[model samples]
Target: MGGLATAMLGCPGMPELPEVETIRRSLLSRLEGRRLVAVAASGSPLRQPIQEAAWQACVGARLEDLTRRGKYLIGHLGRHAAVFHLGMSGRLLVQPASSPAPAHTHLTLGFSDGLELRLVDPRRFGVAVVMPAEEVSLYPPLARLGVDPLEGDVEAALASLAGTRAPIRNALLDQSVVAGLGNIYANEALARAGIRPTTPAGRLSPARRARLARATRDTLADALAAGGTTLADGGFVDGDGNGGYFAVALRVYGREGQPCQECGAAIRRAVMAGRSAFYCPRCQR
Candidate 1:
C-alpha cells in the first residue's frame, strides 16, 4: 500500500467518541428547535431498512432533543425518534435548501427554515431508524451499546479491561466492552500511555492501567476539542464546519515511516485482531 492508503487503513471507520461528539454538538447548534417539515430516505437497500409509511408517519415532528449514545446519534423529534449510526463513512450534512442533494445522500430532512439535513453514506453501512421517541431505548442498536466512554465511570473501564485477556487495543474496540473507541484513538491512547499495543489487558499493573485510562480520556477529549479528524474522503466535521483534530495533532496514528516525536524511534505498524496498530516499539513497553 502507498503511504497515505496505509495510514488511512489503520483507523476504524465508525464514528468514535470524538466524531460523534462533534456531530452531537453540530446538531445541537443547527438542528435544535427546528421543526421537521418532512423526512425521506433513499438508497435501494438500507443497511437497516426503514419502512416507508412508518417513516413518513413519524415526520412533521419537532426536534425535542439531540443525544449521543456511544457511537450513535439519536434525534428526539417529539412523538418519534431519528437514530443514526455513522458506520464507517456516513456523514450528517447540513446544507442550504437550494443546494442539490449529494450523490450518496440517503436521507434528508427538510426544515421549516428553508434548510436541509442530509445523511450521506457512500458505503451504506450507516443506518437510520425512526421510532416512537418515548421508547427509543428499546431499539436493538441503542439497547446493545455499552457505557459511553466519556461519561462512564473510570473505575468501571478499568474493571472491564481487567477481565479481558485480549490485547488492550482489541478490548477497547469491543463495543460491548467499552463504547465509542475505534482503532485510531486506541493507538493514540496506547502511544500516549507508552504501552505496547500487544500488551494483555489483564496483565498491566494498576498504575500502568490507570495511566492508560487517563490517556484514553484525555486523547478523546483533545480530539473532540479539535473537532473530529478529517480524512481525504471528507468523512467528519466539527460544529463550525472545520477539519478534525486527528489531522492536526495525531502522534502515531498516520505517522508511520516517520520518527516518533518523543523518542526518535521509527514508528512501527502491525496488524492485531485484523486491524493495523501503529506504535513506537522503542518508546512503548
Candidate 2:
C-alpha cells in the first residue's frame, strides 16, 4: 500500500458521533416544524429493513426537534419520531424536490416545503425506524448506548473499562463504554494524550485515565468544529451534502511514517482487532 493508503488502513467507514451530530444540527433548521407531506420507501433492507408502517405514521406529522444519541439521529414529530443510523456509507441528504433522486435512494421524505430528505445508502447497512417520541430512550440501540463522551462524564465512563484487559484503543471503540467514538478519533485521542494505542485499558493510571478522557473530548470537539472528518473513501457529508474538512487537522490517524508534529519522530501504525492504530513512537509511551 502507498503512504496515505497504508496510513488509512483500518479507519471505519461508519459515521461517528461528530458526523452524526453535525448532521443533526444541519437538519434541525430545515426539518424542524416542517410537516411531512409525503413519505416513500424503496423496499430495500438496511442493517434492518425500512419499516414502512413506522415511516407512514410520520406522514403529516411536524418535526419538532432533532437530536443525537451516539451515532443515531432522532427527529421528533408530535407523538412519534424517526430514528436513523447511518451505518457504513449511508447518507441523509437534503435537496430541492426538483432535483432528481440520487441512485440508491432507499427512502424519501417530502416536507411541506419544497425540499426533500432522502436516505441514500449503496451499502445497505443504514437504519430508518419510527416510534413514539416519548419512548425514544427505550429504543434498543439508544437504550444500550453508554454515556455521551461530550455530554456525560467520560472519565466515569472510562472507569467501567478499567477492569478490561483489552487495549485502550479497543476499549474506546466499545459503544457501551463511550458512545459515538469510532476507530479514527480513538487513535487520535490516544496520540493527543501521549499514550500508545496498544496500552492496556486496565493498566492506565488514574491520572492517565483522566488525561485520556480529556483528550478524547477535545479531539471530538475539534472534529465537530471542523464538521467531522471525511476521508477519501468514506465520503461523509452533512445534511446539505457538504463534505467534512477535518482530515487536514488530523495529527496521526493517517500520517504513518510522517514526522510527529510534537517530536520529529516518524509516526507508526499497528494492526489491532483488524483495525489500524496510529501513534507517534517517540511521543507516545
Q: What lDDT score belongs to each candidate, Candidate 1 first?
A: 0.79, 0.87
Residue 242 lDDT, candidate 1, scale 0-100: 63
Clashing pairs in 2: none
Candidate maximizing lDDT: 2
> Model 2: runs farther than 4 Å from truth?
1-8
The whole-model C-alpha lDDT of candidate 1 against the native structure comes to 0.79
How would you encode candidate 1's per-residue C-alpha lDDT over 1-285 as one tens digit per residue? Answer: 333453357544456889888888887788788888777778454577656666677667877788988888888887888788887677888888798988888888888788788888877777788888778888877788776779876546667666568888888787876678888888899999999988998888888878988898899999888887776655566434566757658889867788999989899988887678889989899
- Find the candidate with the highest TM-score and give its number: 2
Model 2, 40-70: lDDT tens digits are 8999898888888888878888889998888
RMSD of 2: 3.1
Q: How high a TM-score does candidate 2 get?
A: 0.95
What's the residue-level lDDT of 230 in candidate 1?
76
lDDT of 2 at 83: 90
